[model samples]
Target: MTNEEFLSKMQDVLQTEEELKLDTVLDDLAEWDSLSVMATMAFLDKDFGVKTTMKDYKNVKTIGDIAQKAGL
Candidate 1:
């Protein structure tokens, strides 16, 4: 997917309205919780065929990190 599409999808995954840019910090968003992480995992797996576990989020600091994981 394109970076723009990835960012848009992440907004829905994260349930945030704060204009998610590639550099947006995941931890800074109020919607960035355990549930959001699970949603993200499911989204990535379903849309991009990228499997991820909870532990994988440990190093995820930015939206760009997720885009990388999604191979965007």
Candidate 2:
């Protein structure tokens, strides 16, 4: 997937349209909580067949990490 597609999917998963600035920190997002993490894990698995764990998330500092995992 392309970066735009990844960002769009992230917006859909988070249920937010707040502009996805590349430099934005994931933790700064109001929706970035454990639940959101779980949702993201599911989203990745369902969409990209990439299984991610909470432990794996510790290394994911930004939305870009997620895009990279999705192979964008």
Candidate 3:
């Protein structure tokens, strides 16, 4: 998917009105929580056929990190 589409989808996954960018820090978002992590795992699996576990998120710091995992 295009970067714009990924960002848009992330907005929904994060359940936030704040604009997301590749450089956006996940920890700074109010909606970035355990629930959002599950949503993101589902999003990646459903949309990108990528499998992920909680351990995978340990090193993830930015929105761009997730994008990379999705191969976007």
Candidate 2: pairs in clash: none
Which candidate, 2 or 3, has the higher lDDT?
3
Best by lDDT: 3
Candidate 2 error regions (>4 Å): none
Clashing pairs in 1: none
Candidate 3, residues 1-72, lDDT tens digits: the string is 899999999999989999999999999998989999999999999999999999899999999999999998
Taking all chains together, the TM-score of candidate 1 against the true structure is: 0.96
Put the candidates in TM-score order, highest first. Answer: 3, 1, 2
Tens digits of per-residue lDDT for model 2 on 7-60? 877888887768775566898888888888899999999999999999999988
Q: After superposition, how far is residue 56 of candidate 3 from its true place, in Å?
A: 0.6
Q: What is the lDDT of candidate 1?
A: 0.92
Give the higher-TM-score candidate: 2 or 3.
3
Q: Per-candidate TM vs. native?
A: 0.96, 0.87, 0.98
Task: Give the Å error, residue 50, model 1.
Answer: 0.5
At residue 43, candidate 1 shows an lDDT of 96
